[model samples]
Target: MPYLSPADIRSKTFRRKRQGYDPGQVNEFLLIIADALAGRLRLNPDHIRTVRFAAVPNGYDPLSVDGVLHLLEFQVRNGIVPPTGLNSGEDLRARKLPRSGTGYDRAEVDAFIARAAANLDGRGSMTSTEVRNTRFSTTSGLLGKGYQVQAVDTLLDDLEQELRFRGR
Candidate 1:
């Protein structure tokens, strides 16, 4: 496989989808990744592997984003660009999901994420089934804001997988 360079990352583009990864988030992340590839920023393979973007209407295709991310992760792991620092140790529970005009209730999703993170860390109990079945109330209108539905659902899918791996 050809090694991807900072220029390649910066120049890459994806197809827009009716519902897909948020373009703003993906573009921002791409800039960060490109900088890291150029040794202008410090980021580890784990950061590349675990990165998630919000999903939104008229956004970049998720499959395309995932493919690029997979390649980046593989390249980083293979020493194409040596990582200069350790994981940031940021708490997943503190990470905020992007809000949308019509989406899941932010508070509900936040609470669920906190609970799920605790369960994953062995501080609480939650089942894969629970994660699979979780749902949040939607919010809309001029003043109301909420977490992006597809983004939260994507996170729930990851959490469910982890829970299952842990035999929860």
Candidate 2:
């Protein structure tokens, strides 16, 4: 069982989307996470799990952020972060994109995720700059169903942060 290092939690950035949790509140909570992970704070897993962030415009994406929080909660309670990368494609592959409207283009998101994972594994050639700056087109009328765009972008942004931190 591998614990999530403070550095790992500290370097993460939540993606902001409309009507998400307030960034300031989330940041403050993340500080607690770091301290707790570093043995400088005492907090129960429920403290992280049940935390409420005030709503504000362009705040942290709720679903994406919740996923991270769940993982953190698991780590704190169980003393082991799961054996998975933050942006692992396995979960993404099993995700069912909402069909009510077009989200991010499916193929593009999948391809980029694969490439990003490969890049981290030293099997792909995308530079950190390229991964940080890469953009994908959106789905259009009847083109295809898609995943949530903000979620995917946030994931990529976090991946970019990881790449840059490693490069340094």
Candidate 3:
């Protein structure tokens, strides 16, 4: 069997012991080992996962698959998706709309964009629907009092800019 690199050993070693080496010292050593290994074998620390955001037809908005994936990951991290089968469409819909809430705030929208950006790191474009759905769902909640469904749609043009969506 090939010998493990020092970085590999360090990863395991770092996990143990109550009085481990100072973090700075340990990190310094790891960097040196990383450099040495970098010359011996190609390591792609910068490699990114490829994701494709599908297109949305004329007039609807929803999260792209990538955007959805990001939202799902965030939801999972926050215990919002539960432990299993979280990606099911029904489940996602449930999370998108709480039983009783005014709706997503500016912060929520910002968070959604940030999550999508992370999930689609190097991906080109995003589905128009994906962006719309996020807005629609959120707006639906925000416009709860004396808010007409049709009236909510009237704000789409303005909201689109905030969402950074490119209309198809």
Candidate 4:
């Protein structure tokens, strides 16, 4: 495999989609990763692994960004910075996402998390694709109750990885 340089990462671009990852967020994240790869920033593998971005209209394609992330993770884990690119829910029952005023509906997110935990423990069936496709109603207004969107999305990303690892 060809090695990826920090410059390559910095210059990478993704196709835009109607509904995808926020472009500014993705670009900022790429800069961070590039900096880390270039020894100008400090970021552990887990930090790269768990990073999340908001979804928005007219955003960068998610699959493209995710592919880059996977490569970056590989590079990070193998000490291949500038060369390569890249869960467990045990205690999922005890996991608590921070609440937000405008975010995913708490009830819906909790139920999904429960289901994900059960699936991880071999007590239920849930596919990575399902996790990837999962969506929840958004709570609106300052007083609205919900789970923090980033936290929930991050957890779901972990769960999806676990399921994929297990070939579920």
Question: Predictions ranked by TM-score, top down?
Answer: 4, 1, 2, 3
Candidate 2's error at 41, in angstroms? 1.6
The Cα local distance difference test for each model comes to 0.70, 0.67, 0.34, 0.74
- Compared with the true structure, the alpha-carbon lDDT of candidate 2 equals 0.67
lDDT of 1 at 68: 88
Pairwise TM-score winner, candidates 2 and 3:
2
Evaluate model 4: give its TM-score. 0.52
Model 2 lDDT, residue 146, Cα: 74
Q: Which one wins on TM-score?
A: 4
Sequence-dependent TM-score of model 1: 0.46
Listed in order, each prediction's TM-score against the native is 0.46, 0.46, 0.19, 0.52
State the lDDT of candidate 2 residue by residue for 1-168, as single tens digits: 244555567667877897899888887788788656544458899988888888899888999888888888987887553233444445434444454246777778778777766666667666557865688777675544676665665465455545645661
**Models ranked on lDDT:** 4, 1, 2, 3
Best by lDDT: 4
